[model samples]
Target: MTDSADSRASLGDGIRFAFGTLTVLPVRVARWDRAAARAGMLWAPLAGLVVGLFAAAVGGALALLDAGPLLAAVASAAVPAALTRGLHLDGLADTADGLGSGKPADDALRIMKQSDIGPFGVITVLFVLLAQIAALYELYGESWAQGALAAALSAVTARLALTLASRTGVPAARPGGLGAAVAQTVGMRTALTVAALVVAACAAAGTLFGASPVPSAAGAAHCALAAVAALAAAELLLRHCARRFGGVTGDVFGAVAETAATATLIALAVR
Candidate 1:
């Protein structure tokens, strides 16, 4: 195909991939094959923007229903899961189950791929989601904007963590999967660019919205904590996974992103 034709085809594929992730579609386009991997990676933050905004809107609407913080927080979570159909949540469970096995790399990978959920996986998913809901509930007190910003920060930072993990030596567990695709598509340059963008965004956020953020200190803290916690939690999870399984699967990446976001929000609540 001509270059122009290839560009158009690539664009179509990327749109499909993003749409598939955000909706209940079976479309699965690998990240690398896109003609604009670098630009496409930007989709990560964009997903956060969409998901975060939807979550905040849900909470706001629920507030009008006289829902408590818990209910509002629960509402906040529904949008993300619906958008991605719990894809990352599944990854989190699988990774937790696989790593909890304490078996050899091959064995762990095998267990992770199983359709049946293990005890560890079940508990991990529950606690993580609970933490996120609880923290978001705390942020739901008065400032929808703060809650929305926190959610947005969580989503974007979680994706940024994914971008960060791409630079590490975590090879794909399989030959053909999202892990392999992202690893191949996201190079040093792409990762670095994302990093710079994230930093800039955070700086701008803190300067612009730090003082009036919801729950006052507590709410702002959660938002900031969620962002940092997302990165830290993902790093720890990836390290543990690497040590246990020798490599990361696409599921692990999603799992890590979800887990990190949950942990970040939870930490903010408790702090």
Candidate 2:
């Protein structure tokens, strides 16, 4: 009983840490050890879930208010940035600049650490953000329900990338920072378990939302497919980053999340 209670407490800390680190949420994390960080990665998807719900709510409300899809798409796209202080977007930009430079590993890493965004970073962010808005606008035009479901699931799927990237076989790019701190902290078994749970939860949520008031099988499938596609995209990005950068870094994780989310949204918008 004592051991179970301790485990429960640690899990709680992990959840808190996940939210604290991933979002601009005001939740306080009581622990910051390796154990807590591992636990945090396991629960990171939940942070995405929160972000998704908020984005969905914003988009849904705009749709209800008869706002055009363009405005709704822009607002929904902005929600994650506002909530997370655009952290993932910043990572996406930095990673783009680094990778686009085609420099040696050390120079690429140095470029990524720089504060200024290069031409590659500028173009990447511009196109990526435009793609997200365009996709969400298309989705919203199809059905408000579809837009909401896609928004929520995309967020969750994107965050799932973090767990996969932190698995035991993945290494840190450098000696310190979030990459080193979380590198190899998640075992394969743990990552698979988390992935399974996330998929299940997303499916259930999609079904619930898809069926409310007006049911649409196509909408539900879109959500599920978006999740799967997002995961696949993240996995590909992770592998590429691992090879290109020597291993996964915190920036890599962010880039994966944003890219996955964008890809999912785009997939959902497809006919």
The digit string of per-residue lDDT tens for model 1 on 86-166 reads 888888888888888988888888888898889999998898888787778887664555555566667667666776666
Q: What is the lDDT of candidate 2?
A: 0.83
Candidate 2 per-residue lDDT over residues 153-227, each given as its tens digit: 788888888888888888888888887877887778778888888876766665644545665565566666767
Residue pairs clashing, model 2: none
Instruction: Give the Cα error of residue 197 in candidate 1, in Å.
Output: 1.2
Winner by lDDT: 2
- When superposed on Cα atoms, how far off is each prediction in RMSD? 4.5, 3.2
Q: Which stretches of candidate 2 lie over 4 Å from their true place?
A: 1-9, 208-218
lDDT of each: 0.67, 0.83
For model 1, the run of ten residues with the poorest summed lDDT: 1-10
